[model samples]
Target: MKIALIGYGKMGQAIEAIALQRGHEVVLKVSIDNLEDNTIENIRKADVAIEFTGPESAYENILRCIEAGVPVVSGSTGWLDKYEAAKASCTAHNSAMLYASNFSVGVNIFFALNQKLAALMQPHPEYDVKMLEIHHTQKKDAPSGTAITLAEQILEQNKQKTKWVNHDGSNASDLVILSERIDPAPGTHVITYTSAIDDIEIRHTAHNRQGFATGAVLAAEFLQNKKGIFSMSDVLGI
Candidate 1:
């Protein structure tokens, strides 16, 4: 497959290496310095485009790709607040787009485990649920996107908590999501259900960015000739 890389940073470079290893050609690499490379002609030239940019640029980047009549797979986070807008634009333009909070296969499994555990714990009010996520110091978001997804899943099962708290402490009715930024850490997410009797914890630790890169490549491969917005679950068959 011919691929175009949008945002040639660490993740972009990693994805490029894996795509080449898989015998895929990278036709275009658009970085911050070269915004013109993201134009319609450049984006439409590839079979698919993979985006790994910041939250602020994610929505706009996807919009541009859609306008270019190119399918896209984006792993960017924190711009989900505008997900409706992106979805609407994709439908309006009849483009294919896949977005995921964390593209790691392990993380996707953890997401399933999180939902199952939340359902199991919903009937038992004794257990208090909390989430902790740690990432590299350079990560921009406070609580990682994976953490937010887990928190949302838990809330869907347990209606008692309406929102998530991103700090060490929380109010009486809040589900807490703690964020820790440590140097050189790939990614670590732990969800705990605590009770007077015992504690149940589920964690997914990313050894490196390779898993994410590989997943992005897989998404790009799956995105060819596809339409509408999709997710990692669709890519992994989860």
Candidate 2:
């Protein structure tokens, strides 16, 4: 498989290394310095494009790939407001797109576990749920997307949480998601169900980017020749 890296940051480089290790080739690499080279023609050279760009550029980058007849797998977050538009574009072009807030296989599994736990705790409404996610200081978006996904899963199952707030919710129906930025921390997400009696917590700590990188490559492999929108669940069949 030929992969085009839409963001050449730490995650992008990590994906490239993993893709290569899996016998895939990195054909095109686009970074902030090389924005001009992100043209559709250049992006179309690869079998699939793996985008890990920021909110400001992720939407446009994915559109460029779709327009150029390239299948795209994006792990970018914070720009979900435009996700529907991207999906519509993919369908119109008869192309393929796969997106995941965090592509780590462990993280995706953690997502399922979180939902299951939330359902189990629904009958026992005494437990107040809260989340904390810590990432490297360089991470731009607060309340990391993985944290948001976790919070969303909890809100769906736990009736007590109607919404999620970054720090504190206005009332009990809000799920609090606390975010911390500390250097050298790749990522750490913790979901705790706290009550007067005891605390039950589930945590996923990333020692490095390899898990995410590997999962992205695996998604790319699964995305070949596929059309329409997909998620990590589709690739991993979770």
Candidate 3:
């Protein structure tokens, strides 16, 4: 498959390496300085475009790809408020698009485990739930998108908590989400169910960014000739 890459950053380079290893050609690579290279002519030439840009620019990037009649797979986060608009455009143009907060296969499994554990702990009010996520110091979004998705899943299973509170070391009883941005940590998420008896904790730690890059490539491969908005679950059939 011929691929166009938007955002030639660390993730983009990683994805390119894996795509080449998987026998895919990267026809266009757009970086921060190459705004003119992201034109419709450039985008429409590829079989698919994989986007790993920032939240501020992800929505526009996907729209441009759709206008070019190209399919897209985006792993950008914190721009979901504009997702409905993007979905509408894709539908009107009959373009294929897939977006995921975290594209790691392990993270997808962790999502499934979170759902199951949430359901299991729903009736057990004795346990209190909280989540903590740590990422690289350069990560822009607080709490990480994976943490927000996990918190949403927990809320779906347990109706008692209406919202998530980003813990500021305050003594609040609400469902708390704690975020830590440290030196070069790939990603780490810990969800705990605590009570008087014991504490049940589930965590996913990434050794490096290869898993995320691999998953994005898989999504790009799976999204070819497919239509509508999709998630990692759609790719994994979970």
Candidate 4:
């Protein structure tokens, strides 16, 4: 498999290492130092493109990959308002695209568990749910995308949570997603269901970026020879 890496930062480098170990070749690598090389022609050199860029560039990078008729797997966040537009472009071009907030297989499994727990706790209003996410200090987005996804799942199951707040949620209708930035912390997310009696907590803590990189490569492998929008659910069959 030939891979074109659209973002050559830390996460991108991690993905490259995983991809190579899986017997895949990285044909193109685009980074901030060489933005000129991130063209549609260059993107077309590979069978699939893995995008792990910032919010400002993610949409455009995915679109170019779609235009080049290359399957793209995106793990970017904070630019979901334009997600529908990107999907439309992919459909119009008959290309494949996969997007995930956090591509850790453990995180995706945690997502499934979160939804199940939320549903089980729905009828019991005694338990209030709140989340805490810790990431490296260099992470740009507040309340990591994985936290937002978990909050959305909780909101879907529980009627009381109308929205999610990025702090200590005092409002009864808000799901608190407390975000903390610490040095050298790869990632940590905790979902706690609290009540007057007891507390039930589920957590996923990443020691490094290897899990995320591995999952992205797995998504890319699933997307080959496919044409449509996909999620990690399809990759892991969860």
Candidate 5:
């Protein structure tokens, strides 16, 4: 399949390597250096588009893919407030789009585990839950998108948590999501449930970008000819 990489940063380059290894071609590579090439006419050349830009450009990039009638797999974060709008545009244009916070298969499975554990811990209000996520210093979004996804899953299952806070939460109903930026760290997330008796923790760590890149390519492959919105759960069938 022909793929267009909407963000040619480290993640985009990694995706390109994985796509090529999987017998796919990357037709377009858009980055800060070449914003002029990210046009509807240029986007239409690819069967699918993989978007890994920052939140500032994710919405517009996703919309352009829809307008071009090309399927899109977006792994951007910090712009989910406009997700509904993007889905509406896809529906109106009959375009296909897949979005995921963390495309690593392991992370998705950890997501599933997180939900189950949250459900199991719902009745035990004594155990207060908090999260810690560490990423590379260059990552723009604090608390990371994967951390948000995990927090959301916990919120859905645990009624005690009504919202998530980026730091040590002051409110009892808030889920604390502490973030740290360290060099050489791709990603790391830990969900901890603490009580007077014991502590329970589940974590997911990434050694490199290959796992996420592979999943993005897989998602692009799945969305090549389909329509409507989808998540990583759809691609991994989890």
Candidate 6:
């Protein structure tokens, strides 16, 4: 499939390498310096667009793709407040979009495990759940998007947690998500359920960006001829 990379940063470069290795062509690459290359005429040349840009620019980039009728696979985070608007635009334009907090295959599986654990611990309100996520210092979003996904899944199944707070879960109903940004750390997300008797923990660690890049390409492949909004669960069939 022909692909367009909307962001030419580390993640975008990694995705380009994997897409090329898989025999896919990257037709267009848009970076800060090459903003003019992100025009509708240029975007229409590709079957799909993979966006790994930052929060401030993600919405506009995805919107441009949808407007150009190009299927988009976006792994950008912290811009979810505009997700509904993006979905609405997609439906109106009959465009396809697949968005994920973390596109690593392992992270999605770990997400499933977290939901199940939350359900199992739902009836037993004695347990308290908290999450911690660590990423490279260059990462812009705090608590990481993956951590928010994990916390959301847990909150859905475990009624004890009505909300999530950063760094502090002193309140009984609050699910605390601690974040750390250190140099050279790819990413790590850990969830712990603690009770008076014991603690249960589940974690997912990424050694590099390849896993996420692979999954984003896979998502682009899945969305090549599809229409409507989708999540990683739809692409991975989770």
| TM, every model | 0.97, 0.98, 0.97, 0.99, 0.99, 0.98
lDDT of 4 at 120: 95
CA lDDT scores, all candidates in order: 0.91, 0.93, 0.92, 0.96, 0.95, 0.92
Which scores better on lDDT, 3 or 4?
Answer: 4
Worst 10 residues of 3 by lDDT: 166-175
Please tell me which predicted candidate would have the highest lDDT against the true structure.
4
Error of 3 at 131 (Å): 0.6
Report backbone clashes per prediction: 0, 0, 0, 0, 0, 0
Candidate 3 lDDT over residue span 134-236, tens digit each: 9999999887989999999999988667788887545434679999999789999999999999999999999999999999999999999888888889999
Candidate 6 residues 33-100, lDDT tens each?
Answer: 99988999999999999998999999999999999999999999999999999999999999999999
Task: Name the better of 1 and 5 by lDDT.
Answer: 5
Position 63, candidate 3: lDDT: 98
lDDT of each residue in 32-59, candidate 4, tens digit only = 9999999999999999999999999999
- Relative to the unseen true structure, what is the Cα RMSD of model 1? 1.0
- The segments of candidate 1 whose C-alpha lies over 4 angstroms from its true place after superposition are none
Error of 3 at 28 (Å): 0.8
Residue 18 of model 4 has an lDDT of: 99
**Tens-digit lDDT track of model 5 for 1-238:** 9999999999999999999999999899999999999999999999999999998999999999999999999999999999999999999999999999999999999999999999999999999999999999999998899999999999998888889999885899999999999999999999999999999999999999999999999999999899999999998889
Clashing pairs in 4: none
lDDT of model 1 at residue 31?
A: 90
